[model samples]
Target: MKKIIVLFSLALLSFSAQAQEIKWMSFSEAIAAQKKVAKPIFMDVYTDWCGPCKMLDRNTFSDPGVVSHINQNYYAVKFNAEGTEEINFNGKKFTNPNFDPNRKGRNAMHEFTGFLRVPGYPSMIVIDEKGSVKKTMVGYKTPEQLRADI
Candidate 1:
């Protein structure tokens, strides 16, 4: 019993120590909060069917330094490139007509994607403090590279 308790405690501590955490925030919340805090938006645009997207999420996005920097410098938003939700941004509404709400692993494309033109998997879109787009990064990037982007 003593050994089991010790092992469980050690497991908890190890899980808690993993640092890379991209924030989980809604688009509306990020935009509204950005109005108050004036921070950029760091969005992870991914697809459920994309393997590389999941890889980046599990690796780079899980780094402690990357999580800290993103949370501090930007309002982290996770957007599905093929999600079914209707996203209204800057007076425009974006949705997927072919999107099946009942479908698994597929949805609608964000209208913002059309404007941003990020037709790639695992893209990172950065919006400046004033709500203007600063840059868009695509594909899997190392934690070091991701830090530089911020």
Candidate 2:
């Protein structure tokens, strides 16, 4: 009986490990991955304090179907809309020029977000392999909705 229980636990662990998961990476990492395999880029542009962004992460991104689809079809990127990190893309450097180091709540938007014309939080940007913007989806989206959009 103990051996059977151990075997069952091992099987459960292996199954969990094989479960589909979104490979969320930084913008630069996604770009590098695109160069290697030439897959489309799917970027999730969100803020740390945005409620909808958290919901999207929990509901849509965590869904097995969404995870499998994104992992298979695109290089997933997670970009903080109000972050201070510098991003170099298309021969230009982008940064959050007005980002405050002290203030808490909402912060200045990143330059790359503005460059991509993201008007609000929880924006989803899809880029072609050639580095051109293919589509920009705004607001919260369900797993089914995002799958259809993709």
Candidate 3:
């Protein structure tokens, strides 16, 4: 009986260790998906050069609980704050007109990033099913903090 109990516990531990990943899509995709099935959108706005952003990706987002909760509850989207991707939102096309390909470290901020008015790196923008901005969380957050806030 003790051996059976140990096996069961180990199985449960392995199950919990198998982390689910957040299905991160583009902003446009997330918006389109809302029409089919209304779900809150969670956007992670990060810059390539941001240290905290990388830390958040490694520590918080990789957490099994965070990944599972985000996948099940929100339409997760990842938008690079300084990326060159052109995005269409609310009938307006936003682009990074000032982006320099030759630049080394930091590039120009994307138009949509400025439009969102993100205060700093690693901002998590939560939009409602109707595409209205709900909350903007700035800075790095732990898994527990993210779960509580979202």
lDDT against true structure, model 3: 0.92
Tens-digit lDDT track of model 3 for 1-150? 999999999999887676456789998899889989999999999999999999999999989889989999999999999998889888899999999999999999999998999999999999998768999999999999999999
- For model 2, how does the per-residue alpha-carbon lDDT over 1-150 read when each residue is reduced to its tens digit? 999999999999988865657998988998888788899999999999999999999899988889989999999999998998889999999999999989899999899988999988899999999999999999999999999999
User: Which wins on TM-score, candidate 2 or candidate 3?
Assistant: 2
RMSD to the hidden true structure, all candidates? 3.3, 2.2, 2.9
The C-alpha stretches of model 3 lying farther than 4 A from their native spots are 1-16
- Candidate 1 segments exceeding 4 Å error: 1-15, 102-108
- Model 1 alpha-carbon miss at residue 4, Å: 13
Cα deviation of 113, candidate 1, in Å: 1.8
TM-score of each: 0.82, 0.90, 0.88
Task: Estimate, for each residue in 3-105, the C-alpha lDDT of model 1 and write its tens digit.
Answer: 9999999988888876436677978888899878788888888899999898888888888888888888788999888776667777877776767778777
TM-score of 2: 0.90
Model 1 sits at a Cα RMSD from the real structure of: 3.3
Clashing pairs in 2: none
Question: What C-alpha lDDT values do all the predictions have?
Answer: 0.81, 0.92, 0.92
User: lDDT rank, highest first?
Assistant: 3, 2, 1
The TM-score ranking, best first, is 2, 3, 1
Tell me the lDDT of model 2 at 53.
99
